[model samples]
Target: MSSPRKTSPGKRMTAGLLVMAGLLLVREFAPESPIAIAALIIGLIALLIIIPAYFRALLSSRRDR
Candidate 1:
């Protein structure tokens, strides 16, 4: 049996930020459209989820050192 690879939270956070940036760029092209609104909501939710996890992971890693 193989152990699953662990992904660090910072990397996850970076990916989430990249996705949010992409969504923002897309939204700029269609500022009042439904798709833009949905993208904004999704990006906000992603930041809400990932930012906390990243901070928690950062603190835990420091304690392990």
Candidate 2:
């Protein structure tokens, strides 16, 4: 008998939310300063990369089950 698969919805949601929050924080902190803008850009890049990866992993895990 195979064990039931685990769906980490909470983890996925938390990660996505955290990344979004970080992005918001970066934007709010340095809306005009060049360094803040750079950080915001970097945060956006990271968010673009991370959120999808997290969702993909979550979906793959669910599919595997």
Candidate 3:
């Protein structure tokens, strides 16, 4: 039997750190730039859309189990 593949906590942490670093570099290059503002707004919008879906999925999965 094969086990399910899973991401380790360390891998998740590293990926998060890399993403944060990239965002910091972008901000450093263009502090107060329109692209940065737009990026921020888009990210906020994505979060607003995704978070509700994420919670719904979590609740549904829990209910299934």
Candidate 4:
């Protein structure tokens, strides 16, 4: 039997970013909803924060290899 593989942090962050992007797309059709507005705000903030961190981690990890 094969053991379950562990997911790396970078991959987890990518999934999160993809989800956030999906929410942003959904927000386009429901711009009047307060919840969607809040989600857009939160998602933008997360993208701003996570994108930089993801790139830095990716670069550092590659350098370590």
Specify the highest-lDDT model's number: 1
Query: All candidates' TM-scores?
Result: 0.78, 0.49, 0.52, 0.57
Off by over 4 Å in 4: 1-7
TM-score of 4: 0.57
In candidate 1, what are the lDDT values of residues 1-65, reduced to their tens digit? 99999878887888888888999997999998999989989999889868887997889899999
On TM-score, the leading prediction is 1
Relative to the true structure, how large is the alpha-carbon lDDT of every model?
0.87, 0.71, 0.61, 0.79
Write one digit per residue (lDDT tens) for candidate 3, span 1-65: 99999754444445545555665666778878987776566555555545565566567678879
Clash-forming residue pairs, model 3: none
Q: Residue 7 of candidate 2: its Cα lDDT?
A: 51
Model 4 pairs in collision: none
Ranking by TM-score: 1, 4, 3, 2
Rank the candidate models, highest lDDT first: 1, 4, 2, 3
| Whole-structure CA lDDT of model 1 | 0.87
Q: 1 or 2: which has the higher TM-score? A: 1
Off by over 4 Å in 3: 1-28
